[model samples]
Target: MICESFPVGPFQCNCVILACEETRTAVVFDPGDEADEILGSLARHQLKAVFLFHTHAHLDHIGATDLVRTKTGAAAGLHEEDMPLCENLHIQASLFGLPTPPTPPIDRFLKHGDSFSFGKEKVEVIHTPGHTPGSVSFHVPAFGLLTGDTLFAGSVGRTDLWGGSHPTLINSIQKRLLSFPDETAVLPGHGPRTTIGRERRSNPFLV
Candidate 1:
């Protein structure tokens, strides 16, 4: 198992590259704005990307989707529920004063409980909608968890953006995220990584 995470784009969205060292098969999670960085990382590690999995569809989270897929020939994937958010890239970019890059149609729709493979590891999609209508968390139990906007290091996802609902975020956290084992390593979409047990005991959101 191999993992690499770095911030990309103006918003600095955390882009993660998880790969199987033995098979050299990888998945680029949230490509964001820097396609070159993503591809460079892949080259440095000598891994072949098989899938592009996104935790959600905010413009900042998907700024470089097309560039990455075009270069790597990897399948771009996102939650079905976030298509509206993904499609509204022009509006989303306008909100942040950034030029919108045309996003191509998703190659695949990721859904709850759906599983995808990258070499020896299988990742399951967990529909943890709160930050957005289609927000999800990727669970690779074999290599810990890659939680996107759904969970953070200490604080939980903000429920003030489009399609965001406070109650919904809390419900998703309590019902879905906390259900994982206490020891499961949690790598959120932003900020430092944390653990389920740590977030449960120390996080104000859980209390």
Candidate 2:
């Protein structure tokens, strides 16, 4: 597995490029902004993107979905429950005084337990809402867990936005996320990465 994550857009959402080194096939997670940079990374890695997966529909996470999809011809996916937020990019942008980007169409609706394979690598989708009604986390058994905004290094995702629920978010983290191994790397949407054990024992919200 070849995994690389970088922050993009003003919000600095973490954009991840995960690929199977043997097959040179990739799946891009959250092409928030800077389409050029995302594309460049794919080219640099000599990989072909087959899918664009979004953890949720927040503007900062889906802003560049269309551009990347157009360039790579990759299928775009999001949880069906977040379609409303995905369709309301303009409203989300207004709240932050940012430019509204085009709403990208979802080629697939991801569900809990969904699995995708790019060559020998496989990614399992875990429906872990709370941050948004449809928020999800991607788990690669051999690598790490992509928690989106659900679980962070020392904290957790905010639940003040549309469809967000504090109880649900906490439950999701405790049940869905915490079940992973202690050493499982946690690749959050923003900030530095940490491991499941570190967060479980010390994350203020979890502990």
Candidate 3:
């Protein structure tokens, strides 16, 4: 497994690219913006993207979904609960005073325990809502966990946004995420990477 995560767009949301080294097949996650940069990275890596995935439908997380899918011809997937938010992307963007782009059609609605593979590598979709009604975390045991905005390095995602719930988010983190080995790296939608063990021991929101 090969993986890279970087920030994109004005909001600097974290975008990740993961591929199977042997097959060079990849998956793009949370392409918030800078489709060209993301595409460029794929080209430099010599990887073919087969899927685009979103953790939620927040404006900053799915802003470039349409463009990415167009450029890579990859099918997009999102949890069903976020469909309404995905459809209202324009409205959501407006709230942040940002311009909105058209959203791409979701090829699949991910559910808990759902799995997909590329080049023999598989990722499990863990439905861990709270940040949004449909928020999810992708766990690839060989690589690391792609945890959108749900859990950050020292903190956690805010529940003030649409469909967000504090208690629910905590519950999701405690049950769906912390169960992973403490050493499992946590790749979030923003900020630097941390590990489950670190967060479990000290994350202010969790501890």
Give the best candidate by TM-score. Answer: 2
Better of 2 and 3 by lDDT: 2
Model 1 lDDT per residue over 20-51, tens place: 88899999999888889999999999999999
Name model 1 segments beyond 4 Å from true: none
TM-score of 2: 0.99
- The local distance difference test score of each candidate is 0.89, 0.95, 0.92
Q: What is the C-alpha RMSD of each candidate to the true structure, in Å?
A: 0.9, 0.6, 0.8
Tell me how candidate 1 scores on lDDT: 0.89
Q: Candidate 1 or 3, higher lDDT?
A: 3
Clashes of 2: 0
Ranking by lDDT: 2, 3, 1
Query: Per-residue lDDT tens digits of candidate 2, residues 1-207?
Result: 898799999999999999999999999999999999999999999999999999999998999999999999999999999999998999999999999988897999999999999889999999999999999999987789999999989999999988999999999999999998899999999999999999999999988
In candidate 1, what residue range of length 10 has the lowest lDDT sum?
141-150
lDDT (Cα, tens digit) per residue for candidate 3, span 84-169:
99999889888888888897899999999999998989889999999999999999878889899999999999999889999999
Q: TM-score for every candidate vs. truth?
A: 0.97, 0.99, 0.98
